[model samples]
Target chain A: MLKLIIENISKTFKDKQAVTGFSAELSEGVYALLGPNGAGKTTLMRMLADILKPTSGRILLDGKDISIMGDHYRDSLGYLPQEFGLYRNFTAVRFLSYFARLKGLDKQEATTRVDEVLKLVNLQQDRKRKLKTYSGGMKRRLGIALALLNDPKILIVDEPTAGLDPQERVRFRNLLSEIAGDRIVLLSTHIVSDIEYIAKEVLLMRQGTLIQRSTSEQLLDSVKDKVWKCTVEQHALPQLQKHYKVGNIQRVETGIEVRIVSDQQPLADAVNVTPTLEDVYLYFFNEEVIDGVQAGML
Target chain B: MYRQECYKIFSKKSIYLVFITIVLLLVYVHQLPTDMTMRESVFEELEETWGGPVTEEKVERARESMNAADAGEVSNHTFELRATDYVQFLVTGAAMQKQDQSERLTMLEAEMHDFDEGTYEHREAAIEHDMLQALDDVHGFYLIRSWREMFELIEPTTHVLLLSILIFLGLSPVFADEYTNRTTDLILATKHGKTKLVSAKLLASLSYIVIVFLSLQIINSFLNLLKFGGIAGWDAPIQGISSGLDSLSRLSYDGSPYNFDVWQFFLLTIALQLFASIAVGVIVLLLSFLTKNTMITFFVSSIIIATPALLQQLGTTDGFLGYLTDFSFLKLMQVSTLFTQFQAYNLFDYPVLYPYLLFILFAVVTGLLIMLTYRLFRNQQISH
Candidate 1:
C-alpha cells in the first residue's frame, strides 16, 4: 500500500512560525485537515505537496525523503492550491492536456487522460470553452480534474470547495469519496459537512500545531453531552450565548432554539443533544467565538 | 512539451503587436534617400558598359564618356555625372586610400616605438600593422557602389534595440507568469515540472529569438536591396569602395583590418548580431527568473540592455565606462566598429580581437545565466 509519512514538519516565515511540529502518516483514505484561518493548514499542505520545504524535519514517501525524490515523488502526486489561477486563454481540454504533459503523460495518454478527467468532472460539454469563461464552480471542478489527470496516488487539495455551491460541494465531496479508494487524499477545508461522511480521520490544527487527530465519530463523541438545546426569549439569547458556545440558532414561534456547547447545562430546560462535526469543531475552537457565537456558524 | 512552451510564447497577441511595431520601425528607419536611389540606378546603368576591372584603360573610357556628355554627345546628364564620379573614384579614390593607409601605418609604427616591447600598447600597434599589411594583396577596385551602399547600411543598432524590446517583453513572463498566475504549486507537483519544463521554456525562448532575429534580418536585407537598387560586386574587396555620404563615411570598410570581401563582411555582421541578440535573450530569461514580476523584469532588463548603448552615445568611450561599453551587447551588435580598425585586448601579453572576446564573453555569460535561471526557477518555493 502507498504511504506518505509527514514527519515533524515545521515552517517559519521570518518572525512567525506558520506550521509548528506537525506530523502525520497518511494512507489509503480521505484525511480532512480542519482549522481556522492562519492555523497553517495551507502551509502544512504546501509542504506536503513538496512546493515548500519545511524549516525543520523531513517528509518521506515510503521511507524516501520527498525532497530528495524530487520529480520522482511528484510523479505520483497531485495538488490543488487554495487560491489557484488558470490560464484564461486556454480551453479546458488544452489546460488539462498541458498539465498532463507536465505530469509525464505521453501524447496519446495525455489526450486520453484529458478526455477522461474532463468527463469525470462533468465538464466535457464545456471543454472547448476558454477558462476565462468558466464559472466559479466550473473552474473549481476543472481544478480537481487537473489534479486527477494523472490518477495520482497522493492527492492534496486545499480549500477545494471554497467557491463551489452546495450542490457542487456535495458533488465534489462524493467525487473525493469515490476516488479515495487505495489512494491518500489529504483534504483541507473549513466546511465540516464536506468531510463528515467521507473523512476516515479529521485533523484539527490551531496556531500552526496539529492539536487533534480522530475520526468524525470519535470527534463527535468528545463533544457528546457537551452540546445542549433550549429555547429562550430573543432578548435573553444574548445572556445565554455569553455563558456557552452557541452554534446554530433558529427562529421559532415560541422563542429562539439555540444549540450550545458547554461542559454543563446552561439552562434548567436545556436538553442534551447529539453532537455533529460542526459542534465538535465549535467545542475545539470555542475560543474563536465572538459575542457568544461562533464566527463562521454552520 | 517543447511545442507547448513555444505555443505559450507564440500564442500571445502581444508578441504579434511587437512584431508589427518592429516591421514599422524597420521601414521608417531604413528609408533610402531619393537621390541615393537615383545614383544607385545610374551606377547600375553605367556598369553595363564600364563594369570591367578598374584599370587605366577603364579610367580613360569613363573620362571619354564624361567629356562626351559635356560636348552634348551623351544624352543623359545623369549618366555624365555618374561617369565623372566613377573616374574620380577609380583614380583619385584608390590613390587617396593608399596614401591614407600608408600614413596611418607610419603613425601607428611611430607610436609603437614609444611603448615598451612587451606592453599592450606595443602589441596593439603590431596587430594593426599586421592588419594594414594584409591590404597589400587587394586585387583591384571595381564598380562596387551597390555593395558599398549595402555594407554602409548594415547598421545593427536599431535592429538590436528592437530585438531587445521583443525579447524583454516576450520572455519576461516566461517564469514570472507561473508565479503570478499561482500555477507554480500545480506545475511543481508534476513529474517533469522541475527538469524538462525548464529546458522546454529555454529552448522555446531561444527558438523565438532566432526566428525573430531572422525576420528582422530578412526585412532589413529586403529594404537594403530596395534602397541600393541591387547587391552587386559580392566578390569585391571591402577596401575597394567608400560612400560619399557623410553619415556613412565612417562605415567605409576601405581601411578595415579584416580582408573580407563584401559578402563575407555582410555575413559576419549578421552572425555577430544574432549572437548578441541571443545573449541578450538569455540575460532576459535570468531576469525573469529572479524577479517574478513581469513589469519589474522588463523594466530592469531594459535598463541593463540599454545602458551600454546610452553610455556610448553620451561619449563614454575613454575610461572605465568605455572599457565596459567595448564589451557590451551594444558594442557587439555594432559589428562595423569592431572590424573598421584593428581592435584587441591584451591577455597575458597576448592580443585578442574584439570579435573573439565578444563571442567568448557572451557565450560564458549565456551559459552561466542559463544555469542560474534553471536553478532558481527549479528550486523556488511556491509559498505565495
Candidate 2:
C-alpha cells in the first residue's frame, strides 16, 4: 500500500507561524482537515502539495523524502488549491490537454485522458466552451478534473467545495469517496457536511494546532450528552445565544425550538439529543470563541 | 508545453492590435511625396544616360549641360542639372576622403616615432594607422537616393525603442500573469513546472520577440519600398551613398571603417536589432519573475531600455557618461554610429574593436539574466 508520512511539519511566514508541528500518516483513504478561517488548513495542504517548502519538516512518500524525490514525487501527487485561475481563452479540452502535457503525458495519452476527465467531471458537453464562459460551479468541477488527470497516489484538495452548490457539493463528496478506495486523499475543508458521509477521519484544527483526529462516529461520541433541545420564547433567544453555543434554531408555532451544545442542561424541559459533526464543530470552535467574546462584552 | 506557452502569448488580442498600430504608423510615416518621385524619375533617366564608373567624359558632359541650363542654351535641363550636380559631389567627396586618409596616415606614422617600438602607445598608433589604410576607396553611385534615404530611415535608436515596447507588451506577463491570476500554485505543483516548463517559457518568449521584430521590419521595409522605388545601388559603398547630401546627412557615413556596402550595412543593422530584442526580452522576463506584476514589469523594463537614450539626449555624452551611453544596449541597437568611426577599447596592451566588445558584453549579460530568471522562478515560494 502507498503511504505518505508528514513528520513534524511546520511552516512559518515571517513573524506568523501558520502551521506548527503538524504530523500525520495517511494511506488509501480520504482524510478531511477541518479548520475555520485563518486556521492554517490551506498552509498545511500547500505543504503537502509540495508547492510550499515547510520551515522545518520532511514529507515522505513511500519511504523516500518528497523534497529529494522532487518531480518523482510530483508525478504521483495531485493538488487543487483553494483559489486558482485558468487560461481564460482556452477551451475546456485545450486547457486539460495543456495541463496533461505539463504532467508529462504524451500527445496520444493526453488526448485520451482529457476526454476521460472531461466525462468524469460531466464537462464533456461544455468542453468546447472557453474557461472565461464557465460558471463558478463548472470551473470548480474543472478544477477537480484537473486534479485527477494524472491518477495520483496522493491527492490534496484545499476547500474544494467552497463555491459549489449543494447538489454539486454532494456530488463532489461522493466523487472523492469513490476515488479514495485506492489512494490517499487529503481534503481540507471547513464544511462539516461535505465530509460527513465520506471522510475516513476528520482532523480538527484551531489556531494552527490539531485538536482532534477521529472518525465521524467517534467525534460525535465526544460531544454526546452535551447536545440539548429546548423550546424558548423568541425574544429570549438572544440571551441564550450569548450564554451558550447555539446549533440550529427553528421557529415553531409556540415560539422557537433551539438546539444547544453544552456540558450541562440549563432548563427543566431540555432533553438530550444525538450529536452531529456540525454540533462538534460548534462545540470545539464556536463555543470557546463565542464564550470569550460574550464574557468580554459582559 | 512550449507550444502552449506560445499560444498564451500569441493569443492575446493586444498583440494583434499592436501589430496593426505598427503598420498604420509605418504607412503614415512613409507616404511618397510627389516632388521626390519626380526627382527620382529624373535620376533614373540620368542613370540610363550615363551610369557606372564615374568617367571623366560623363563628368564633363554633365557640367556642360548644367552650364547650358544656366546660360539659357538648353530648355528643361533642371532635372538633368540636379542629377549631374549630385554626381559631381560624389566625385569630389571621394577624392577628399582619400586625401584625408593620406594626411592622417602621415600624422600617425610621425607620432609612432616618439614611442618605443614595443610600447603600447606605439602599437596603438600603428594599429590605428593600419586600420585607416585598410579602408577601400569610395566607389561610384547610380540612382542611390532611395537606398540612401532608406538607410537613414532605419535608425537603430528609433527601432530599438519600438522593439522594446513590443517585447514589453508581449512578454512582461510571462511569469507575472500567473501570479496575478492565482495560477502559480497549480503550475508550480506539476511534474515539469520547475524544469521543462521554465525552459518552454523562455523559448516561447524568444520566439515571440523574433516574431515581433520581424513584423516591424517587414512592415517598414514594404512601405518604404512602395514609397521610395527600387533598391538600386545596393552594391555601392556606404561612403559613396552619403556623398552629395547636406552637411548634416553628409557626416552620416563620413569615416566608416568597415568595407560593407549598402546591403551589408542593412543586414548588420538587422542583426543588431535581433541582438537588442533578445537582450530586452531577457531583461523583461527577469523583471516579470521578480515583480510578479505585469504593469510594473512593463514600466520598469521601458525605463531601463530607454535610460541610455534619455541620458544621451540630456547631453551626458562627453566623458565617463559618454562612454557609458555609447557602450549600452541602446547604442548597440542604434548600430550605424558604431560603424561610422573605427573605435577600439584598450584591454591590457591589446585593442579590441568597440562593436565586438559591445556584442560580447551584452551576450554575457543576457546569458546571466536568463540564468537568474530561471533560478528565481524555479525556486519561487508560492506563499500566497
Candidate 3:
C-alpha cells in the first residue's frame, strides 16, 4: 500500500509562500528530504504529519485524504519536530509513558511500549533520570523513542540528527534503516550525510519547490564529468574559485590544489573527479538552469 | 491525570511556602491576648484622655447645687450615680424617710421644675438617676469594646490569607509552564489535547484550590476556637437603636451580648472563600494562558484580588467606589464581623454577591480560554 501521498500541496504563511505546488509519494522505505535552511522541508513534512494543513492541496494516506480524518488519521502517524520539547521535570520513563497514553495506548500497553522504545534508543539505563539532566544527544534519542511509541506506519522526523555526534548519528541511521523495511520514514535534514547512506531516494528542494527527485546513483551520475580536480600555483587558486564552482580546496606542500565543477576544463592539467552528494546538492542549488530545461527543474 | 497534577502541586516548593505563611499568620492571631485585656487598655486610655471616671467628690458637689441646675445640669447629674448604688438607696430610703417629708420635697421640685411629670423626681433624685445612667452607658461601651477587639483579631489572619494564597498558587502555573517548556505542541497533537487536556488542567487547579482552602480553614478554626472560648448566638442589637429607650430599660440588654458561634461563621467563611478562590483561580488560569508567564500571572491576579481591599481601607467618605468595596470578596470573607454586637456597617452581613458573579464570569472566561488554547495548538507551527 502507498503509505503516504502529498498531492499538489502548497502552504502559505501570511502573504509568503512557504511550500508551492509540492507533490510526492512514498511507500515502505526511507525517503530523504534534502534542502538548505528555509527551503520549506520542515513545512512539507509538517503537512504530511497533519500537524499543519496545506493552504491548498490534499495529503492522503492509503488513498484516503487525511485532512478530513482528524484524530483518527493522526493515530497511526508519529512525528518528531525539529526541536523536540520535553518536560524538564519528568523522568524519561514518565515522559514516554505520557506520550504513549496520548497515542491511545492503554496502561499496560503504554508501559510495555515505553520500555521497548527506551531500550531501542539505548536509553533504558538512563530512563529513570529527569530530562533536564540529559545530554543533547540523549534528548534527541528520547525524541526518536517518543516518535516510535505507537509503532507508527508513517514516521516524520525533521532534522533528526542535527546535533548527534558521529557514532550516535551512525547508530541512529542504522536504527532508521532497520525500521524503514516495511514502513515509510520521511527524514528531513540540511546535513547531506545523514541521509546519504540509508535513503532509498532523495528529494532535492530549493526555494519552496522540489527541484529534483532521483535515486542516489542517478544524482551522482548526472554530475560525473562536471567535477574536475587540479594542482595549481597558490596565486592561480583565487582565479579558479572565481571562475568555476569550487567544491573543495586543500593546500599541498608544492602549491594549492582544488576541485571545481564546470561543463568544460577550466584549469591546466585538470583531471576528472568523482562527484559527491554534496557536489550534486550545490550544483542544482547554485545553478539557475540546467541546459534545455526550465530553471525550476533539474 | 488529575492525581498526577495534584502531585505536582503538593511537591512544589511554592505551595509549601504558602502553607507555612498561612500557619504562621494563624498562630500569630491565636496568640493574641484575651479581648478583656484589649478593652481594659482602651478604657484606661480613654479615661486618661477624657478626664478620669466620675468621682464621688465631683458628684456630691454637683448634687448640692440643686436648681442652680441648668436643666442640662440635672440630666448630667442623673448620669453620675451607679445603677446598683441608686437602686439600693431607693429601696432603703422608702423605709427611713417620712412620707410627708418625701411628699413635700417632691411638691417643691414639682413647683420648681414641673417634677410632677412622670419618671422624674426632686433635684436629689434626678442627680442620682443621672449618675446611674452614666454608669450603665459605660458598661455597655465595655461590652461592645470587647466584641470589636475579638472580631478584629480573627478576620484578617484566617480568611484573607487562606483565600488569596490558595487562588494565587493554584492558578499561576496552569498555562505558563506549558508555554515556557514549549510542550503545547505535543499536547495539542494528541487525541484529547484540546478538550481533555484543558479540562484536566482546570480540574487540577480547582482540586489544589479546594485542598489549600480547606487546610487553611480547618487550621484557622481550630486555632480560633483554642484562643477564644466557645460562645454561640450571634444576633446582636443593631446599632442606633438606643436613643428612645429609658436608661433602666436600655440597660437591660446593653451589657448582655451574643456571638455567632465561631465554628458556624468559620464554615460559612470557608464556603465563601472557596467559591471566591476558585473563581479567581479560573480567571488567573485564563490570564496565565494568555500571558504565558508565571510572574505576569501573579501580578495580574494580585491586582484583581487586592484592588477592592485596598479601596476599602481608604474608607467610605471617598464616595461610590468606597461603597463598592463593601461587596468585595476579600471583605466578605471577614466572618469575625458577624460576631460583633455593632458593626460599622451592615456590609458583611449580606450574602456574598461578587463571588457568585465571579464564578459565572470565570466559567465563561475559562471556556473562551480553552477554545483559544485549542485553536492556537491545532494550528501551531512547531519551531526549533
Q: Residues B1-384, candidate 2, lDDT per residue (tens digit)? A: 899999999998887887787667667656633334323676777667665545556556666765776788766547556556665555545555666767888988987998888777787788788877776655344455455544433445556666677788999999898888788888888898888888999999989988888867776766666666767767877766553442113335646666777888878877876887788788888899889999999999878768888897888788888878867767766666677777788778777788888888899999998888778877887787
TM-score per model over all chains? 0.91, 0.92, 0.71
Q: Which stretches of model 1 miss by more than 4 angstroms?
A: A289-298, B28-32, B38-79, B106-118, B136-141, B145-154, B246-250
DockQ, each predicted model: 0.77, 0.75, 0.28
lDDT of 3 by residue, A235-267 (tens): 887777656778778898878788878889876
What order do you get sorting by TM-score, best first? 2, 1, 3
Error of 1 at B230 (Å): 2.6
DockQ computed for model 2 against the true two-chain complex using alpha carbons:
0.75
- As for candidate 1, its interface RMSD to one decimal place is 1.0
Q: Which CAPRI level is candidate 2?
A: medium
Model 1: DockQ vs. true structure: 0.77
Write candidate 2's Cα lDDT for A18-101 as tens digits. 999988888899999987787889998888888899999899998999999988888888899999999899999998988888
Q: Rate the local accuracy (lDDT) of all candidates.
A: 0.80, 0.80, 0.64
TM-score of the A chain in model 1: 0.96
User: Ten-residue segment with the worst summed lDDT in candidate 2 chain B?
Assistant: B243-252
All-Cα superposition RMSD per candidate: 3.8, 3.1, 13.2
Winner on DockQ between 2 and 3 is 2
Itemize residue pairs with steric clashes in candidate 1: none
The best-first sequence of candidates by DockQ reads 1, 2, 3
**What's the C-alpha lDDT at position B379 in model 3?**
60
